[model samples]
Target: MSTRNSLRSAFLQLKRRSSTNTGGVWSDFSKRPTTLKINNAPIRQTLFSEGNSEEGPASLTNGDERLAYHSPIAIDETFQMAYRILEKEANSKYQIVDRLEKSLKNAASQEETIEIKDRIDKNLIEAEIENPEVLYNAEFADSKLLDKSQPVYRHLLKEKWENYDLLVTMQRLEQLHVIPDTLPTLVPKADVKVKFTHNTEDQFSKWVTPGSLLPAFAVSEPPTVYIQEFDRVEGSNNLYTVLLVNPDTPDLATNSFTTTLHYGLKNVMLNNVDNSIDVSKLLKVGPRITFKEYTPLTPEKNAPAQRACLWVFRQSKEIGDISEASENFDIREFAATHGLTPIGAHIWRQKFDRSVPGVRQMYGLGEGRVYEKVRSMDPLNL
Candidate 1:
C-alpha cells in the first residue's frame, strides 16, 4: 500500500511540470531561438519568423532583428485570384476588339472607321500590357494571335527573322562573294525562302539552306518561294519581283563567266500573310505575274559548279511589260531601269551529275556539251 501511494505522487509531479513548461507545444516552439550559430557566427532563420515586423519575437535577439514570413497556402490563393482577374480582363478586351472590328467593317463613313480603328488599337495595347505572354511567347504562340493585323505580332516575327535567318543569309552572301558578283550590294528587308515541291521524294523538297548543294533533278522544275515583308504598310499591298540568276554560266569562247537568267517574275502582289508564290498562287492570280517562265539550271558535263542566286526586289511602282530574259542578261541595268530595290537574296549550288542528262531531256533541252579535262602546266623555272 505504501509503494502504490509513492508511484501516484510521482505521476502527479510529472503532469504538473509538463503543464507549466511554456504553456504548450506551440508556446515552446515560439520560444525557440530565432537565430542559429554556425562556426560561432549568428545566422538568422527568416523562414520560420513571424510577420514582417521590425521587431523579432521577444524571446530572440532582444527585439532587434527584423522578421519576414510567408504562408504557402496564402501565397497560392493570392496567385490564383490574380490569375483569374487577369484572364477575365483579357477576355473582355478581346471581345471589345472583335466588336470593334465588326463595326469597322460596317462603318458608314471614313470618320467612323477611323474612330473604330483607334478604339481597337487602344484595346489591343491594353490587352498586351496586361498579358504579354500571349503576344510574345513564340513557342506556344497561337496562329490567330499571329494575324498580320497585329503590329505586335509582326514585330515579334520580324525580330526573330532578323536575329536568325537574316544574319545567316548575310554571312553566306558575303562569304560566297555573291555581293559584287551579282549586284553591287544588298540591304535585305525581307525574309525569303525557296523549295522545290514538284518532286516530293527529292531531298530538296523542303526549304533549301542559303548555300546548300542540290542535285540537278531536284531543281529540274519550278520552285515554290515565300517572301515575308515585315515593313508592310497597313491596308496596302506590296509589289515584289523575284529573279533567279546563274552567275557561274561558263563562256567557252571567252574563257570567262557570264550570268544567265533562269526565272523572272514581276508585279506579284504580296502582303504579310499571303506571301507564297506557288503553282496554286499562280493559277489563282493568272499568268500575268510571270514575265520569264522558270527554266532550271542544267550545268554542262565536266563544268564547274554553278551558283543559282535568287534575288527578291521591292518595286517602286507597278512595272509595265518587260522583255523576255536572255541567256546573257544584265541584272544591274534591268534593276535600275525597272526601279527595283534589292530586299532579299537566296542561293543554292549545283554541279554536273549523272542526273543532269535525264533532267535536260525531261525539260526538252538539247544534249549538254562535254568539255575535256584540261591539265595545269608547270610553273616556269626561276
Candidate 2:
C-alpha cells in the first residue's frame, strides 16, 4: 500500500509540471487567457489586429473605405444604392429639359428665348458626353437607350447601316443590275428603306427587302420611304429628291421595255432623325414637297415581271420647275440638270396578277392591254 501511494504522488507531480511548463509538448493545449495585459489594459489578440496596428478600423461612412471590410452581400447593397441615386439624377435632368422646352415655346421676350436656348445647348452637351457608349458599342446598344435627336445615336445608326445593311443593299443592287438599268452607276451615301403600309392586313406592310418580289395587291398604293443621312451638317436640313421608276414597262410596239416614272418628290427636307416621308407627311405639306404624286405601277395582263427602281438623291440646291412624270421619263438627264447626287436606291419586282385589274381601276388608269406571249423557234432563244 505505501509503495502504491508513492507511485501515485510521483505521477501527479509529473503531470502538473508538464501542464505548467511552456517548453512541454502539452503546453499549447493547456488553458490560457484569451487576452494579454498591455500597459495595465487588456488587449484582445486577433489575426488581423497585429497586421492592422498602424491603420485604424475601416471607415463606415466612406464608401471606398467601407467596401474593404464589407462582405459580398453588403457590397451588393452598396451597388444598388448607387444605381438608385444615378437613376434619380437622370430623371431629374430629363424633367429639366422638358420644362425648358415648354418655357421656350411660351417665352415672353427675346432675352428669355436666348437664355433658354443657351441652357438647352448646355444640357445637350452634357447629355452627349455622358452617352458616348452608344456610338462606340453600337452593336450591343439597346434601342430604348437611343435618343434620335442626339448626334451620337445618329452616328451609331449610320455606322450600323454601313457595316451591315449598306453592304447587303450594294450586293443586291449589283446582282439585280439596278445600277446599270436605272442609272449608269451609283455611289450610295445614305440608307434607304421602303414599305407600303396602305393595306395593314397584307403581309408586305412592313419594310420591304431590297430585292423582294411582292404581289400586286401588296404594293398597290404609294410606299413610305425612309432616308437616313449619315453625313451631318449642323443648322441645316438637307434637300432630297425621291424618284420611283419602272425600267421594265413593256413597250408592245417596239417589242422591248421602256422606263416610266410612277412617283416623284422634290425639295423634300430630311434630317438624321426626321427621315421618313409617309402619307401623313404628304397630307401635311403635299404642295411644297410633291413634284409628282404617287401613281401605282399597274402591270398589264400577260406582261413579264417588272422592276420598280426607287432612287434617292441629295441636291446641291433646291430644284426649280420640273416637268410632270411621263412614260419615257429621262431620269439621268433630270438628275444632271438639277445637279442631284445619287445617294441611295431600292428595288422590288412586280408581276401581273389578279389584283392588278382592281388596282388599275382604283388609280384611275383606264383599260389595260394584254400582250401575246411571243415564242421563238430556236431552242437557245430562252
Per-candidate clashes, comma-separated? 0, 0
The total of clashing pairs for model 1 equals 0
Q: Each model's C-alpha lDDT? A: 0.71, 0.68
In TM-score terms, candidate 2 sits at 0.63
For model 1, which pairs clash? Answer: none
* Stretch of 10 with least lDDT, candidate 1: 32-41
**TM per candidate:** 0.66, 0.63
Q: Which stretches of candidate 2 lie over 4 Å from their true place?
A: 1-145, 234-237, 375-382
Instruction: Tell me, by lDDT, which candidate is best.
Output: 1
lDDT of 2 by residue, 1-382 (tens): 6985565456444434333222321112242111111111111111112223123233234655644442332332353344345434544555677789999999999779778866765554343333212222344435333445554456667767888889989988888888898899988888899998887774688789888988778987789898877665334338889999998887655657789998899988888667889889988887888778788787887777788899999888988888765788889988898999999999888888888888888888887988767744333322
Quote model 1's TM-score: 0.66
